[model samples]
Target chain A: MPIACEETGRALTVRVEGEIDHHAARQLMEELSRRLDAALPKSLTLDLGGVAFMDSSGIALVLRAYRRMVALRGSVTLQNVPDQAAKVLKAAGVDRLLPWNE
Target chain B: MKPVNEAKLTFWSRSANEGFARTAAACFAAQLDPTLDEVNDVKTAVSEAVTNCIVHAYPDQLGLIVLRLRLYPDNTLEIVVKDSGVGIPDVDQARTPLWSTGGADRSGMGFTIMESFMDAVKVRSRPGKGTTVTLRRRIARRFPG
Candidate 1:
C-alpha cells in the first residue's frame, strides 16, 4: 500500500492506494496513527480513490481512524471510495457511521 | 456434485500470505470468466477466511494453512480454507456480526462479510484441532455483446 499525507490549514488528507487486507491494514493503522498523532489536525480526510480492493479490514482501519480522531477531538471523513470498497463498507454498515465526502 | 476443476494451496499462517491467497484464488477463478464484482467478492471472502486462520486459528505460532478451490459445471465456485490450530470454542458467537476477540484493530465482521459476498458459508471446527471454512458462490453466465 502507498499512502500520501498532507495538511492544509489543520485539515489533513491521506490518500491510500492499492489493496487493503489484514496484512496491509496493520501497516496502514500504524502509519495513520503516527501521522495523526504528529499532525493533530482539526479534521482528517481519507481519500481511497486509488484503492483497487478492500475487505472487512478496511472497516477496522476506518473505525480506528474515527476513534483516534475522537480522542484527538478532531473530525474524520472518507472520500473517493471505489465501488468494490464501497460494497464492503456498505455491507458492514460503516457507511452509516462516518460521513463521506461526495 | 463433482467438481469439474479443482486446486489446492498450502502456506504458512503469515500476514503476507493473505494477499497471496486471495490473489491466487482470484487467478484460479478467472477461468470461470467472472465479472469484476464476482471476482472481487471471491477475493474478499478468501481474504477474510485466511485472515481468520492467521489471526484466530494460529494466534501465537506459525502453522500450516490450506486453501482448496473447486468449480462445478453449474458455474459454482467452492473455496475451502483449513487451518490446524487453536479452534473456536463457540462457533455461534464467532459468527455474530461485530464479534471479534482480535482486539481494537479488528472489526469482527469477517464472517459477516463472507456471508454477504458468498452464496453460502459453512464453518466447521474442533477445539485444539483446527477450523475449516467452506464458501460457495455461483457466477452468473454472461455473454459478450
Candidate 2:
C-alpha cells in the first residue's frame, strides 16, 4: 500500500493507494496512529480514490482511526470509497459510524 | 451439487500473500460467471480466513497455507483455506466478534465477516495439528448446457 499524508491547519488528509488488506493494514495502522498522535488534527480525511481493493481488514483500520479520532474529540471521514469497499463497509455497518466525504 | 471445476493454491504464511490469495480465489470463481458483488463477497471472505492463518495461526514463524476453490455444477463456489500451524483451542470463543487472542490491533471479526458473506462456513481444527476453513457461496448463475 502507498499512503501519503499532508496536514493543513487542523485537518490531516491521507491519500492511500493500492490494495488495503491484512498485510498492508498492519503497517498502515501503526504509521497512521503515530501520525495521529503527533498531528492531533481536528479532522482526518482518508482519500481512497486510488484504492482498487479492500477487505474487512480495511474496515477495521478505519474503525480504529475513528475511535482514535473520537478520543481526541475530532472526527474522521472516508472519501472516494470504491464500490466494492463501500459494500464491505455497509455490510459491517461502518458506514453509519463515520461520515463519507465523497 | 457436483463440482465442475476446482483449484488448489499454496503460499507462504506471510501477510503480503493474503491479497494474492483472495484475488486468486476471485479469479478462480470468475469462470462460474458470478456477479461482481458475489465475487467481492468471496474475496472478502477469503481475506478473513487467510488473515486468520497469518496473524493467529503462525505468528512467530512462517508456514504454508493451502487454499482451494471449487465450483459446483449448481454454480456454488466453495473456498477452503488450510494452515498447518497452531490450531485454535476453542473454536466457539474465536468465533465471537471482537474476541481476539492477538492484541488491540486485531478487530477479531474475521470469522464474523466470513459467516456473513458466505452461505455456509465450516471450520475444522485440532490442537498442535492444523486448521481448515471451508466457505461456500452459491452464485446467481446456471451452467449453460
Tens-digit lDDT string for candidate 1 (A2-101): 7899899899999999898888888888998999988999999999999988988899999899999998898989999999999999998878888997
TM-score between model 2 and native: 0.92
Work out the TM-score per prediction: 0.96, 0.92
Task: Provide the clashing-pair count of each candidate structure.
Answer: 0, 0
Which candidate's DockQ is highest? 1
Cα displacement (angstroms), candidate 2, residue A102, comes to 3.5
lDDT string for model 2 (A1-102, tens) is 488899999999998888888888888888889889989999999988898888777877888999999999999999999898887777678889888977
Candidate 1 error regions (>4 Å) = none
Candidate number of the best TM-score: 1
Q: Residue-wise lDDT of candidate 2 within B33-105, one digit each (tens)?
A: 8888888889889998999999989989999999988988777888999999999999989998778887767
